[model samples]
Target: MPGKFVVSITCAKDDTDKATVGFVVANAAAASDKDTVVFLSTEGTRLSQKGYADDIHEEGFAPLGELMASFAEAGGVIYVCSPCFKKRGLDEDNLVSGAKVVGGAKLVEFMSDGVSSVSY
Candidate 1:
């Protein structure tokens, strides 16, 4: 069976460095042929929006937008926290490709199986 990789990100533009690194790891997992999910919560939920990641780039790393697009191209999932998204008034229609607003139950279901998780 394939390995499952989960990356939980709780910061968005508020902490671009952490978010960028988290996606980099997630891309690596997906590139390794694992089932990868980037679970975005709190401030991180904002990243699910189209163009939100466009301006974020950390030194010595790929731009956040490019990393995100590559992750999606490599079959990674971006799970946005529903409540957090709504609380922040984000538009679901504008979510980036491969991203979906989901509840905690959805995350629980994904983690019900044996998996590795990292948080940022």
Candidate 2:
């Protein structure tokens, strides 16, 4: 069976370079036909908000918003941390397309099947 891949992102902005890299990897994994999910926790949950990544164009890379949209369109799952988003006072009604607000248990459930994970 194909392996499952989980990407855990915890950054809030373009300055947090690791988050960008993690998203890139997750996109690749999804494209590779692996079961892929991106867990947005802590500051990473900010990306799930509509327009939050709109102007975030990292040098030498695709725009973060475009990258995220492409990943979701390609059948990758985006799970935003519910508590983190709530703590940051984000608007759930304005979530980006293909994003879901879920608790840690949801993430745990997705990764329970011996999934490979990378954290950023």
Candidate 3:
């Protein structure tokens, strides 16, 4: 089987450029036919909320929400950190499409077979 690619994101707002890039990379990996996942931790969990990323448009790139939606639409899995989400008191019922709240074990399971990972 092809190797899986995992992106561990931990940023928010404009400071989340690297995290955004990590999603983009995961999207690219999926486009290349690899299994890809973006694990949102810390502030990155905010992106999993409805309307949170709506107004965030990065210059020279698609809107953050759009990019994220596209990535998920294209089969990129989005895993939001359970503790992070709870710490921020995010509404679990309002999680965006394609996003799931999971514990660290889920992430570890996905990458257990020598999957490659990049942190943002």
TM-score of each: 0.97, 0.93, 0.93
Q: Give each model's whole-structure lDDT.
A: 0.95, 0.87, 0.85
Candidate 1 vs candidate 3: which has greater TM-score? 1
lDDT of 2: 0.87
Could you give me the TM-score of model 1 versus the true structure? 0.97
Query: Could you tell me which residue pairs clash in candidate 2?
Result: none
lDDT (Cα, tens digit) per residue for candidate 1, span 69-92: 999999999999999999999999
Best by TM-score: 1
Shift of residue 79 alpha carbon in model 3, Å: 0.7
Q: Model 2 off-target regions past 4 Å?
A: none
Candidate 2 weakest ten by summed lDDT: 12-21
Query: What order do candidates take by TM-score, descending?
Result: 1, 2, 3
Between the candidate structures 1 and 2, which one is better when assessed by lDDT? Answer: 1
Worst window of 10 by summed lDDT in candidate 1: 1-10
Per-residue error at 36 for model 3, in Å? 0.8
> RMSD of candidate 2 to the true fold?
1.4
